[model samples]
Target: MMISEVSEKFDIPQDTLRYYERIGLIPHVNRNKSKIRDYTEEDCRWVEFVKCMRSAGLPIEVLIEYVGLFQQGDETVEARKELLIEQRTQLKARMEDMKKTLERLDYKIARYETGIAQTEKILRRPET
Candidate 1:
């Protein structure tokens, strides 16, 4: 497929795709006879994977390095596994923290609700 197709399919901007290529986040894409970028299914998969990892808070530099390692073949398998494992651990910890924060927010919301209910009750009482 062409670059535009890739952008539309992945819901990513053209410049971002170019940036990914420029920054070594993805491998060099094949070019058509007209010198246009021709993305393959594998290329699309990589783009989607990179997008998912980035949205999950994985740093771009980390991804760039991961891609570099990934392109180096089987010798870097163990190192790549270690990197993914470490990121997963960190993401899990962050998710736990976010859960705690959500709990705190829920508590505050309930408190506000209780206060409003109490105020409504007092306002409805008979005048002295």
Candidate 2:
């Protein structure tokens, strides 16, 4: 597929895709006769993987390292796995922090709701 199609399909912008290629975040994409990007299935898979990792908050440097290891052949399997495990651990900690923040926000909202209700009740009372 063309770069535009890949961009639409992946919900990523063309410039970001080109940046990814330039930064070695994804492997080199093949170009067609006219020098337009022709994304193969493997290339799309790399895009998907990188997108998922990025959404999960994996650092760009870590991903670049992982991709580098991937390009070095099968001998780097364990190293890649270790990198993924470390990222996963970081993601879990971040998730926990987010959960706590959400709970605090919920509590604050509830308290505000209660205060509003009490004020409304006082306002609605009959005046002498």
**Per-model C-alpha RMSD:** 1.2, 0.7
Q: Quick one: best lDDT, which candidate?
A: 2
TM-score of 2: 0.97
Model 1 agreement with the true structure over 13-101: per-residue lDDT tens digits: 99999999999997899998999999998999899999999999999989999999999999999999999999999999999999999
Ten contiguous residues with the weakest lDDT in model 2: 52-61
Q: Model 2, residue 66: displacement in angstroms? A: 0.5
* Whole-model Cα lDDT of every candidate shown, in order: 0.95, 0.96
Residues 52-118, candidate 2: write the lDDT tens digits.
9999888889999999999999999999999988888999999999999999999999999999999
> To one decimal, what is the Cα RMSD in angstroms of model 2 from the true structure?
0.7
Q: Please report the candidate that would top TM-score against the real structure.
A: 2
Consecutive 10-residue window with the lowest summed lDDT within model 1: 2-11
Per-residue error (Å), model 1, residue 81 = 0.2
